[model samples]
Target: MRPPPLRRLLAALSAALATGLAVPALRPSPAATVQVLAAARDLPSGTILGPRDVRPLALPPDAVPAGALRENAVGRTLAGPMRRGEPLTDARLLTGGLLRGYGAGTVATPIRIADAGVARLLRPGDRIDVLATPSPGAPFSRTVVSSAPVVAVPRLRSDQGALIVLATDRTQAAALAAAGSSLSVTISGAPAGPPQNDGPR
Candidate 1:
């Protein structure tokens, strides 16, 4: 004995309740997270990672970097620079094949930066343009290497000078060697580091 409108209302409410219950089953679950090691500080290439250099992080599965492992990464050298908090991945670690893809004439060369301040600031993977004055007090102003990648920035020694590794051709290496003590450099954000001197390659 229900009216047509009343019967329709009852049917509509039943459908609404069914939809609300069904939606929970259809809802997507939260993605799982993985524990991985993340850099604790800005790490330059060639740096030997230490216990304090990294920390564990819980990251979403998809956000985890490839080759990332939760195991201790201490003592491993880096082949590339990493920003603080960046995930430490296998590919970024030092490997023999790192230089396999370089263009012809590329060679690893080490030079000493005259300025300790600049040398301290240089990190591996940094790009530096080499300039030489040719003569001191005259304007250290000749281009030796243009936009060369810093392969390594070795830890500075108290007595031993700071050494910066560069990727360049043999000829350019010779040029840098000759510029020794007269070379200067420029970097982004800071007055460029002093030019490198001829040091062991």
Candidate 2:
């Protein structure tokens, strides 16, 4: 037998009401997010960040990495390549903070590379041997510091030779200083050994 029209209407209304109530319970509330600076576009290693190089991104609190920067990323050099939207962190920039993890007695030493073209290829964290060539016709170059890790590669100027900062101990720093303008570098596989304190070898 067919239900009465009024009875059927009431049953449909009850079912609709139940669904409306359940929908709210099944849906979740929006999560809160925190804003942090991120790469605006694909950036190569050694790029000096500028205003347009970074943008603000909102991420879940737990998603944000330790040492992520909320601001002040501009003018900092990138330690490595970053994809668009990657969060900026202290570890990704070339700064004084980078030296802290290198250990005690470690110093950031700035040296001029004899070949600007060769220096241009270096990025942070690269292990290289600092060499000193005696002259234009020198048969062999001497290694001033073996397997020093490059920490920073500053932007080059037309009037200046390429300059790169290396993380080295006091002894290596002195040798690099003595090498001066004769400094050249060759990329090496891994660090050659623990920090050498016996002087340049």
- Poorest 10 consecutive residues of model 1 by lDDT? 192-201
- Using Cα atoms with residue i matched to residue i, what is each candidate's TM-score against the true structure? 0.42, 0.48
Per-candidate Cα lDDT values, in order, are: 0.70, 0.79
What does candidate 2's lDDT look like per residue over 3-54, in tens digits?
Answer: 9999999999999999999999999999999999999999866578999999
The reply for model 1, stretches above 4 Å from the true place, is 1-100, 134-137, 188-201
TM-score (C-alpha) between model 2 and the true structure: 0.48
Clash tally, candidates in order = 4, 0
Give the Å error, residue 58, model 1.
Answer: 47
Instruction: Write model 1 residue lDDT over 110-151, tens digit each, in one string.
Output: 666566577777776677877665555554376677677776
After superposition, candidate 2 runs with Cα above 4 Å error: 1-94, 135-138, 191-193, 197-201
